[model samples]
Target: MSAAFFSRDIVSLPPSSPGMRIGLFGGSFNPPHEGHRLVSRECLKRLDLDAVWWLVTPGNPLKDHSDLAPLDARVRAARALVAGPRCHITGFEAAHGFTYTFETLSHLQKTLPGRRFVWIMGADSLAGFHHWERWDEIFSMMPVAVYVRPGSTRKAAVSRAASRFRHGRIDESDARLLATLDPPAWVFLHGLMSTLSSSQLRSRK
Candidate 1:
């Protein structure tokens, strides 16, 4: 980590300020690959984001950790992938000790105040989002942008969060407006996707 980056309250995190459009993409990143970058690229172009931060989590509360790689190793693998000037990889959740999505976002908001934060996820996650801890609070905390995945589009659009917040759903054409919108606001984007995931990658070994 650079000395300048080490200056943040959240260790090794890149600098972001008020009014910047930042997309938060959180995950285990056990072996971050091109698929992750593909989504980031789409988010940057379509959402008009200033940056996309990959929140490399320490562990997933709902996932089995038996085959999970070390956090440092995962971060290193993610760092090896190509990213645009604005994209970043960070272990902030582990550095700052946050366990849940809602708590993580809340802490980031407090530390980096006045900035627009968008929760980025794949439609596959939406299908099972109801199982996350304090999942609804996550929706109410920031604007969300979910992109269609290879096999999860229909299931995601009909998900619990999708149904409950149906009125909050924004049209894809208006995606550029998400960063400035209030909480409970989200949009479902359709486009290119990768059939890759950490679990899938690990199973191949």
Candidate 2:
């Protein structure tokens, strides 16, 4: 199961269908759980996407690499938990040797043409997103959906990125059209908040 789960011989990885409205949900996915599943489903439904790629990254620049489990272990756990056609778990970052979000997004844009990709993340991530490397470049590359998260609505709303791009925010009713819009566009989804946090889950261990 371990050998086949990752099969490190992979190069380039399989591409998604062209013109597919895909959501790029990038993360370490240190431990797969129901909350990640719930977020993907909600993003798919709200954005009217054809599929959601859970980009299981090799490592996160913002996180301590030593604190994370082995890449294959994390990917295997993700593969085990993610089911159905719309949800895809790909270790593209690890396979392609990409580490940062900007690098991955740039690669995807060049690799998959005609495919509309939207960056998806919880509100808490948004609140601190400005601190990320080339964070502004990320906004310029794709539309972002800041899903409502427990206790993060206010902080995210007033975040540096949100404030800088406040004018680019569109109504929730127009969420389905996010992929069609240009960069600097984003939407904050309210009332769809989830109570799950990866850190919270890890703490219980």
Candidate 3:
């Protein structure tokens, strides 16, 4: 399917149950592509999540917003790319007025206490997470699952956040258990990496 399918008012989506174990992959999907789908699929297969939620952010705090497409447009693009019973594209934060990852996690945790939530991200983001607002609070709130993206594995391994929380890294085989672990736990997944990126896609456009 094309990338135009995700364009919808996320506020209209139904609420998720608290019994589910979900992975939240938030980003400014200016244009969703195969890379985003691949990483999410890998996260589901390896981490055993019930579903992967693509939280299309209004804008990423770390990146300039000048190039970002309209939030609804990006959401639609993401929905079109993500096709499966296990995947969901949402702009819930926009409806909830959550502008930061830490706040989003906090809101979800409080709203759905029974569901286990894991923060899914690529190595590149993990590497720079230390600079995120309330970065330490995120670590203390939920288990993080980091997937190795090409060219980012090495730098992420030695990143300040990784080094500081190195003790929490678990074996790849145990990655699925991350959702059950206490806050601050994480795992590094190694597998096929997609070379496509949003920046590269935008530049070509």
Clashes of each: 0, 0, 4
Model 2, 1-205: lDDT tens per residue? 2323556532235457788999989888878777788889888998999999888877788887766777777767887898788887777576666768999999889978889999998888999999988999999899999888888889999999999998889999999999889998999876555576767777788
Model 2 ranges off by over 4 Å = 1-14
Off by over 4 Å in 3: 1-8, 12-14
Tens digit per residue, CA lDDT, model 1, 56-149 = 8878899888888877777777877955579888887776667788888989888899999999999999999999998999999999999889
Index of the highest-lDDT prediction? 1
Q: Give the alpha-carbon lDDT of every model.
A: 0.87, 0.83, 0.84
lDDT of the structure predicted as candidate 2 = 0.83
Give the Cα-based TM-score of candidate 3 against the true structure. Answer: 0.93
Q: Clashes in model 3: which pairs? A: 6-76, 6-79, 6-80, 7-76
Indicate the worst ten consecutive residues by lDDT in candidate 2.
Answer: 3-12
TM-score of 1: 0.93
Error of 1 at 153 (Å): 0.9
lDDT of 1 at 125: 95
Query: For model 2, what is the alpha-carbon lDDT of residue 180?
Result: 89
Q: Residue 147's C-alpha lDDT in candidate 2?
A: 85
